[model samples]
Target: MTGSVTVAGLGPGDAALVTPEVTQALSRATDVLGYVPYVARITPRDGLRLHPSDNREELARATHALEIAAAGGHAVIVSSGDPGVFAMASALFEALETWPGDRHPEIAILPGITAMLAAAARAGAPLGHDFCAINLSDNLKPFALVENRLRMAARGDFAMAFYNPRSKSRPHQFARVLDILREECGGDRLILFARAVTTPDEAIAVTTLAEATPEMADMRTVVLVGNSATRRVGRWVYTPRSAESAAG
Candidate 1:
């Protein structure tokens, strides 16, 4: 078999949102690898093998998938949300950078609906204008960098979506994030907390920066902060598409 490695996204917790392209890749996979929860989403079959690992083993998982593919097996690596966005695709390429093997197996990255986009949709076009996505985890980068990016994005009046906003381990950082937003964007700016988007337990709340609390968000939440011009009409929150809307 001509071996291939396909990195696929499972999308935010909804089966319906998983792309057909990713589904096709999984159906043909001889070996599959991913974080435990993501791997669990895949159905087990007679000829398929699932390699589930802890969150910290991304590089190892990617290398193993490559090895399997190079040996003429169809390997599929899964990730929640798009693999290219803070997921397994980057790790797979990082392994390829130092790959000692002469033969490079075919590699492909398949996209899926990410949590930020799902959350944005739930809140109705909050990202209609210019926006930026930021990962607030600080696992691979410094917290100062996160702070700087938050400040710059807010100061530039761009709509923003945040991933990995708050967790039990670092519960207090999100408080600082809220404070920074208040300083840069003022108290009346719109902020949204969308949790478990597209899943049965999904909850979405839109509030002002002044009323927003850190406890409202968790690891499962995707937070959205609207630009200065973002507002609510009836019940929907959205940013006006015109540049003049910001100045008006």
Candidate 2:
């Protein structure tokens, strides 16, 4: 009897953001696996098989979690932010493809609040229209891919949010993003940086793509580059009129 699999979203930087479904899933999981920082955010369950590691160990950890579930243990693959949005959900499926076991466990991915959505809501309405999320880390992907995505967003005039924009090893990648936007977008494009949204020390600031310097951003910052239609109303930034407002 193989135990079920639950890919849970732990939410953005707060316990309060944990959904009831995710909380229920965690309560039933026998093995809870995730990157160490995310795993630590949840309370220690009575009998959870806790496995934590650095970000570099993602594949190995996902494989181990599946193995545990195939062996009839209730297992959970946890991620910060929504599990499916550039998070752990894809890794679980990819790892399962190479799995040799016959045991098919019930795998469920419960959704939760993502950092982009939460950050946008906290700072105002930066993502009030069509948007894009681009991950800047070149560790797993090529730098070309990152730039290509940026180019796409710039061309589409999509409101853009960036993830994993910078780290110790890749400090200047986000600066390149700004350059791409400034070249494709105008010099006055509204840009907002929301750091640690919904957390105790959260910071939100509005700037233009031409004005958002590297010093104003870090890995903790979720960056928002506005679309052609996006605009700032005092502290709040918004775009794409709602259907109700449009009809009126």
Candidate 3:
């Protein structure tokens, strides 16, 4: 009665955005685990056990999920947005590093729409051109490393999507990020602050680096910085598919 583990994405607060594969896995799961709010998204049923933990307990959660699977119980770990994008999939693989090879449970990662894609769509194709996604949380990495990546991405003129931009504890860091972007991408650059995309509380703000403020983003926000070419067409914001300075 060997069991298995499924890492499934719930897709950014919208029930309709969840993929069929993830839905199927959740339907068959004997136990579901995730961060507190993500686990709350699951409807409790008679046979399904829900395990919710704090956001900082990703490794512990992954280990627990694996342990349940190895014990012959079907386990599923849920993540908001795609699990592989700065989410549970990486943490699960990291936990597997110490897992005994002979007893490793079957694992599957099912994809879902990530925040950037959802945000981009709502903002009218701001990510239609070359782009990069960066998680701004300094929980697992150094602030200096985050700054360096930000500088490089701006220097490359890549449209950028940012996740976990601000939280209560590290409120000041996002201000520094805005400063860095202003330095590297210039003050006139276009920026979009998309908060709680597709949910009932959704709000989208389009502005420029000069006008962008740190308070515009909270943990639920996904920020987008367009390359020099990004602009408005009527009420829509978009970066064209071709580079601004490209040769014929």
Highest TM-score among the candidates is held by which one?
A: 3
User: Best candidate, lDDT-wise?
Assistant: 3
* Candidate 2 C-alpha lDDT tens digits along 40-125: 87688578768887887777877888778777898888898899988888888888888887655678889999989999888778
The true-versus-predicted C-alpha distance at residue 235 of model 1, in Å, is 2.4
Ranking by TM-score: 3, 1, 2
Instruction: Tell me the spans in candidate 3 whose CA falls farther than 4 Å from its real position.
Output: 244-248
Cα distance off (Å), candidate 1, residue 3: 1.3
- In candidate 1 the C-alpha lDDT for residue 62 amounts to 88
**What is the per-residue lDDT of model 1 for residues 119-230, given as tens digits with 9 covering 90 to 100?**
8888899999989999999888999999999988987788999999998889899999999999999999999999999989999999999999999999889999999889
Off by over 4 Å in 2: 242-248
So what's the TM-score on candidate 2? 0.93
- Model 2 scores worst on lDDT over the 10 consecutive residues at 239-248
Cα displacement (Å) at residue 205, model 1: 1.0
TM-score-wise, the better of 1 and 3 is 3
* Count of clashes, each model: 0, 0, 0
Q: In angstroms, give how far residue 61 of model 1 lies from its true place.
A: 0.9
